[model samples]
Target: MVKVLLILLVIYSFSYGKIITGNWSDPVTPIMADYVKRLIHKAETENAEAVILTIDTPGGLDTAMRDVIKTFMGTDIPVIVYVYPPGARAASAGAIITISADIAAMAPSTNIGSASPVQMGGRDIEETMKKKVINDMVAFVKGIAKDKGRNEEVIVKMVTESLNLTAEEAQKQKVIDVIAENINDLINKVDGKKIEKNGKEIVLNLKDREIKKVEKSLKEKILTILTNPTVAYLLLMIGFYGIFFELYNPGSLIPGILGTISLLLALYSLNIISINWLGLLLILAGILFFILEVVTPTFGALAISGVIAILFGSIILIDPDSPYGDIPLQIIIPVVLFSALFFISIAYLGLKAQRRKTPTGSEGMIGMIGKAETDIDPEGKVFVSGELWNAYSDEPIKKGEKVKVISMEGLQLKVERVKDGSKI
Candidate 1:
């Protein structure tokens, strides 16, 4: 595709910035990191003038952000990060990635900052730990700013105090290199810039060049949705519910299959979210309790405990600060209530089925009454429920006399003559 685009670039010879763009509209994840890494690699391989990554995100995992920054820094081609369109932000890890790029740019109405390292649920770090975290981040951002030749003074405050700056303020403070109105403005301004990469300085010479976009891979696309907090959590619950339904109604086929699929998807997503393993274990245990409730009819005791366990597990399962935010109470509450109700209903059904009389099995005829088709002193042939059975009577019975089925051993039924004409 790049080759084809390059051919067009040569053929058309339209004079402008030869830009290869990557959109970072999603929260940073391992998948996003890989996507950007490949983007840069492709840009370098194709010898493009520069690579521009337009970032628009609230925040995401720190590790994923760092990985993306590492990729941008290692590339030989000039990498540019732009916060574009109206009302976009380069918050948290986005700010870090922006500063790490060779050239940082932002459009009007955009903002950047808020690099504080909070937990998944937006809980701040405790006293001693928070100080340490802030200091470490200060030192880290300071280093990144120094290496990239951007301002570190404001960045330090950004991490410690969650300072946010508009595009104009960022440019004025040297937090970013350019403040453009849009992508076209960015392309025009960066046309004559020179940057040193891998000990070699390259002139951008971007004017009159074609722009190409880097598309995401299939794996990246699927993983992107899995990183969403709401989606991942839903998948997790659906997975458990599916499997639970299957277990309650064994051999139903559909429920189990759906549950397996949903669960696997949830697991894959949770892996990216970096959820607490213990929380996940607790959730699984709670689900087991629910299953036990159905199997043993524990009078709702197990189901109640299961609900508690699931609620707690879900609350702490995901860190509030994770790209996948803490599982919302709305989701957890409904899921728990639904799960409990389902388990209780299923238990009731199981007990009811147990109490129901057998309609057509060996036990069905235990107390059925039939007339003796043939009789002997102690043996006869009896007709019961439309079937003839060999019979043994404890007392003598005459042919055509009604007999009560007392028991059965193999094909023979133990019976006796009806005493008071009791109806079957």
Candidate 2:
């Protein structure tokens, strides 16, 4: 009985070695970096055999990519970067991360490479800066390749020449360890692979291991939404519109509240994503020009310039090479046109309002025709603006006669007898 119990306990203890698995299907942002860090920490705490991250990205921010690579390389547990799904391609930063993994892998029909760095908007940097960036990226990839025992020459070519390769081609070049059909296949292929960690050999025994799938936490999901570039851009535009409307019609609680919230959120998003200072400045300047147009009535000159500034600003707001990519022109054009129309209409209405005569106050009394309540020789009371006021005129005026208010005086109105007086 004692021996049977001992044997059962041993079998139960060794039956399932756990492995952590998750998907990274979006651009690498600060939020994503924090997520990966949390996953790594979770895997470490759970004593998992390995972490299997399935990737499908067009690449992302340079700083974020480096942060992810550091997390992978710094961990004791073996980290596998699998370019999964048939149609997936690990380009740019994704390619570099793949080559940096303890076990780089891919699904059938997948491809990797194209690690060249570019500025925001997918444009190359200036020549001198381009060479520096290219050389730096080349060295970075080469070092990662060397450390992971991958083909350094080919990996360097991926940066310098933007070389890309299919799964079979990558395998032929010794760039990946396995071509997997799925997660299960990946596990089986690398089940017995040995990795060096902290000068010690750590063997993966991932066969039939319990797969612990990681899901984003609620906080992570919210942060993900907030960090999205498109969401950020929209928030910024909405913030501006809200604040502008609030200024145009003061005491509008809704616009002020929404504008403050949206502006804060947008600013937070900007902190996480790389942005162009010039683009942000241009956008602000555009809004200022719109306000000036309303205040000064520039005959649409400043309004036109505002439109142009905003258009260009929207085009270049996000970094050209950012993983999220530039804001689509389809969205930009409609937004720009609509915003221009909105502000222009407001400006026109403001100008019109200014031209309108006052309905109350001293200015309202000017040019008004009223009946003289008392006979006057340069001093008398006159009924004006529905009230009898102390009034005086240059010439004598009779009672029950019409008078025209020329101007206002302290507690009085300066008036003149109406020429060809009609009915009061």
Candidate 3:
């Protein structure tokens, strides 16, 4: 009677319960870590049968990644991390995460490994420090692998030698439990797998369970966009352009205000992206060079160099190994080309404006030719630039005689004779 009752209870629990799942597709940011932690917490609170995380990431910040691993370690629920879909990979921090899960599984066409930490953001680590970093990672991964009953030596190779493994090979080597083609298949394979989690052994009741996905909240969606490398890069460009336009044409309140707002937004992103000071300096230098090109004649030399500098700086701005560093080449190419064209256009326009006839102020009268409307020995009324003004000349001015404005004083134009309708 007790056995039948137990079986009936299990059936009831499977029939009317939630099987929680989450898809982590972004580079592992702190926010991503938080998201996963929340999902785990929610699952635990609701007495979920299991939590399946479908992960596809190129890796991300080390601190955030470790925090996620820590959360997995502390969670009472069985956390099954699956590297899913074809052609997907669990790389860098991702590899560690998969290995650390209570049950690590992968799809047929997926891969795992490549957890080696490369120098990002700045220059290469000093030799002594590099050894220390590698040792630390090796120790950390080895510990996780040991606890998870994964092959520690081979896992060490992932960090030391940057080794990668196909899903089939991984399953054969016991790195992953199974190579499931889909969630249903995965459930069948891992249905009764006993795993140790949260200081106790628990069975993953994957059979016939309802899969409930924890969708990202609106805040997380916005946060994801803000931390995106491409989005941040574009924001940075917008900020630069806005400020440049405002500076170029001062008192244009709209551009200045817009620039300030964009800059603040960009700065917020940069903070999240983790600013590399050297990279930031290089970007600033590039802008300075472009501004100097507009002010001084450098034959487009400064402009070209500035574009190159900005391109290189932006490339190195985010850590190369981090998710933020992987801005596509397609984006970089267009941005560089656009920046060069913009600077050249702005500089050309600025120089042209300098050479143009002045429209107002004392210097505006120079080279302006007009007809004298009233006769005078040294002063007269003259029409120039569509406006009549009092004028003076070293030479006598006569009525209806064409006069060339050579200078201006106190709203009066200094004139020279325009004999034969041409200034002599």
Candidate 4:
């Protein structure tokens, strides 16, 4: 019984010092949220001393940021958020995350702060709205700072006024606990440090421990790609052009099918992100107007309105606070103008083709003078434009009477006697 007890103690010791490292660099998507939850679960199951979250992000969705904060608040594992790699930062939502951690640390040259919340769209909010948002964010940050034993006043300033600080200053002000040059040093400094988590005492034992990396899954990769502004923009254009190509050519299956797929993907992305619904509707309306102009040739009026709508819609399609905000105005303006020109050009060509006279076969031979090779009352053969055509005439004519082709009816040509006696 003594030997068995000793063995159990040894096993518990071996399981008590696990370190789980999580690297988060982007806005927290649902998949990212799940991944973090799984990591937390793994750490708890393995009896981890602490969970280290390596953060390097500009910001992300407010809801996702809140989700991460909720996870941290509920977890038993002591979460240490470390902003590493010298030049990294914890801006926007990252600031909230860093302040919420059990132990915050940063590498030399790294910075953190700037937690002001703005409207998702680029438009500025009213003064009252701004005050409300700032006050709420202040309360949130103050709570996290209080829980982490950091300076709540400084944290409030960081959120409301976008204050920035270097790692050294952060450590000096107790905003962070330590400023390590690298991960190795961080581990050494944190090892054997007693931390209370959920009212239980645990000591870190991270000396010489192996580091494991958790990667995003394939589905997450696809989501990241779709969320990209450039890719989403391209998809929208491809969808519009695909449908347009199908409409112009009627029976081409490839363009139509591809366009439908692209448009659906674009729509799916827009739906997932926090997009201005009005902007989306305006873009759809623009496309419809352009298509109508193509069908009915609206002398640039529809084209002009369509261009304006498309420009406004594209500019406002995705939330400005989102990653999509990186899309340049230069790109947007040129693409909108070019797209409008392309539509107009196609419409002009179609209208021109419709108004032009026929240039092929018997239908093209109308108004050409021809000689009657055989003559009768209303049915005979005539040579017109160097081709023999079945002919009909209201006037009586001799065998070689000169006749002018007036019109074509199926395979027959209707003709009248030429003013001159010459056979044509």
Candidate 5:
């Protein structure tokens, strides 16, 4: 009886202890991919029975997505992708990942699909580009489906045709294996299922198992935030303008410093996302043109061209469908318009200031010829407009002889004699 109890205790220990759990929401940035790879390695080294991947994302970087898929495929542990809570979605890359799991499950009110490959900026790709993208995506999803023993044809349809479905429909069509309302239900349903890992079959024993969640590290969190489209765009704009402002008006270090930091952050983000360099160049050109409009009057021609270039460049900067959907047209249109208006206003103000007459010091006093009211010699005192000044003149003049102040040096005024009968 003691031996029996010992055997049961050993069974329970092996069944319940060391369950690994991971969460992925953003369609897997490079940082997230690395994190997941590490977690999988840890699970394998520790001989964890299950690696639970909780998902809630609209999808993300394609390269990162492929990296995650490779990690999942190579792991020697059962990976169960669970779409949790109400209203959660496993769209785009998330759907492909979900289908790649050993066991795919979702909570009530969750969804999956819309696996179309859009332009990097989330707009519809040109026909040629679209064909290449569609073919690649279809091939990828089909491979995942085959590996996980899901329906390849349906996966292809989903990717090529942009099909979406409720969790129930997905499960019914055999595209997904299960549909559980929560983690507990998932645990119960998958408890006795068999999965192959490291070429060996192992049955899951998740009944009463403790679930532990592994979160992204702080570094990963920061990288993920930087990869966001809105944040990335803002950083790019701030960096560009800051540096430009600093260069335009030297000795102001604040803009330069801020610009450097923003640019660095934006570059890091662009490295992670699919960015077209041509679009970046166009944006730079647009800024240069706008600045030229301020420096040299172009009658709004340069400004108009700059605005058009900037708008076009921004629209084409990133392929919306690449992973993160393109920047919404609504968002891009307004930003372009506002940016154009801002630069134009600055140009107009600059032009107005340039055209205005000088208003300070000696420049303001140039045309005001004053009369000397006292006798003037090369070094004599004179009264001009109620102020006494050291006066100098080549011609000797009697007291009260009218003399016109011609120029000034320090506190002295140089004068010329007023001819007889000439206007003083």
Candidate 6:
């Protein structure tokens, strides 16, 4: 009886569908793509009534955008792309993603469009290549618009002429299905709306439904941080410095461990964002120069070269085409300057201090001038280094004569008679 009751309860829970919503505020990177895929999969597993994705992005990598769209299309449940918070935008690739959803929605005062493709550094492609890319993107967007029953003609203008549309304009032009004030308004407006997916019509029953807001998992948050371009570059630098400090002062486990971890995470992040090989090599060369500056000071020559190389390298390290964007000049300039200073000033002094010989141990007894308390031919007791010890000398030392400690053997000191006694 209990087993039967459990099965019925499980069925009852799934019968009343729940809505799954996620906020996407970052650029569409591999991490974002993965998150969207997981979000949709979670909805499918839970048999959700719908999935609402609130997006506010400046577009991102083409590949990541395509992955997100693919994930949305493959799912059986309805996917709604909502441009929310009134001041948000669905610019560039975001426009296409917005239109590709089963139900495209936007909050008041929001806008969408500008889905044109450009080269790295925001430069336009050559005339020949320009047409090819434009045509390709046009067909992709038009196809999606046609499938979603949106206005294909107006939507394609977003690619051809970089046309943008306000929420009201989008709604009027049939570019978007709904203009909602908020999530609740969107739910109430689209409630019982019918949309065709894979040749089957799906009715959205979102009114008064249980809404489950999905947030990034801890692992996802960490990956998101690692994938940031600035953060990744910082991690790389930290790794280098940590390892450098560890090499200078061995057995200081903390720096070495932190450096290793930071470096590995940096490499992993670099893998996700496309990087220029020349830029990376230049940065490495700069690091090498900085290290050389520490080992062999060149009166700022090596340090200057290192700073220049690092600056150029950092400028080009991130691919211009990367959706994650470039490292800010403000960060780069200060970091390069600080790196040069650290390598030359702190590194040199610290290393010198570490290499300096200690003067407090038994070796400190060497070169000390002390008076011989007892006179002897070969071995005599002498006071040196603030203590009395048995001393030996090749020459005879008279009582009360000055002697210099040359070396130490066990508890005794090897001394020599000072003809002209001078305190050392």
The estimated TM-scores of all candidates read 0.61, 0.62, 0.60, 0.59, 0.61, 0.60
Name the 10 consecutive residues with the lowest summed lDDT in model 3.
318-327
Q: What clash pairs does model 4 have? A: 369-424, 370-424, 371-424
Q: Across residues 155-200, which tens digit of lDDT does each residue of candidate 5 receive?
A: 8878888888898988988988888977888888899999766578
lDDT of 6 by residue, 9-73 (tens): 99987698899999988766776787787778778878899999999988867787898899888
Candidate 3 error regions (>4 Å): 1-16, 121-126, 247-250, 272-424
On residues 27-130, what C-alpha lDDT tens digit does candidate 2 reach at each position? Answer: 76765676788778878877788999999888877888999998987788889999989999899888888888899999989999888898854788899999
- Location of the lowest summed lDDT over 10 successive residues in candidate 6: 316-325
lDDT of all the models against the reference?
0.81, 0.81, 0.78, 0.76, 0.75, 0.83
Q: Model 6 lDDT vs. the true structure?
A: 0.83
Candidate 5 at 123: error in angstroms? 1.1
Candidate number with the higher lDDT (4 or 6): 6
Candidate 4 C-alpha lDDT tens digits along 368-412: 877889874778898877788888888876678788888888988
Q: Pick the candidate with the highest lDDT.
A: 6
After the best TM-score superposition of candidate 3, give how far the Cα of residue 141 lies from its true spot, in angstroms: 0.4
**Model 3, CA-based lDDT:** 0.78
Clashes of 5: 15
lDDT (C-alpha) at residue 337 in model 4:
88
Candidate 4, superposed: residue stretches over 4 Å from native: 1-17, 28-31, 121-123, 247-250, 271-424
Q: Residue by residue across 211-300, what tens digits does model 1's lDDT show?
A: 899877544565688678788789889879888987899755456545654665577577733446546765886798789889888677
Candidate 1's displacement at residue 374, Å, is 32
- After superposition, the stretches of candidate 6 with alpha carbons farther than 4 Å from their true spots are 1-13, 120-123, 233-263, 272-424
Report clash pairs, candidate 2.
119-321, 120-319, 120-320, 120-321, 121-320, 121-321
**Model number with the top TM-score:** 2
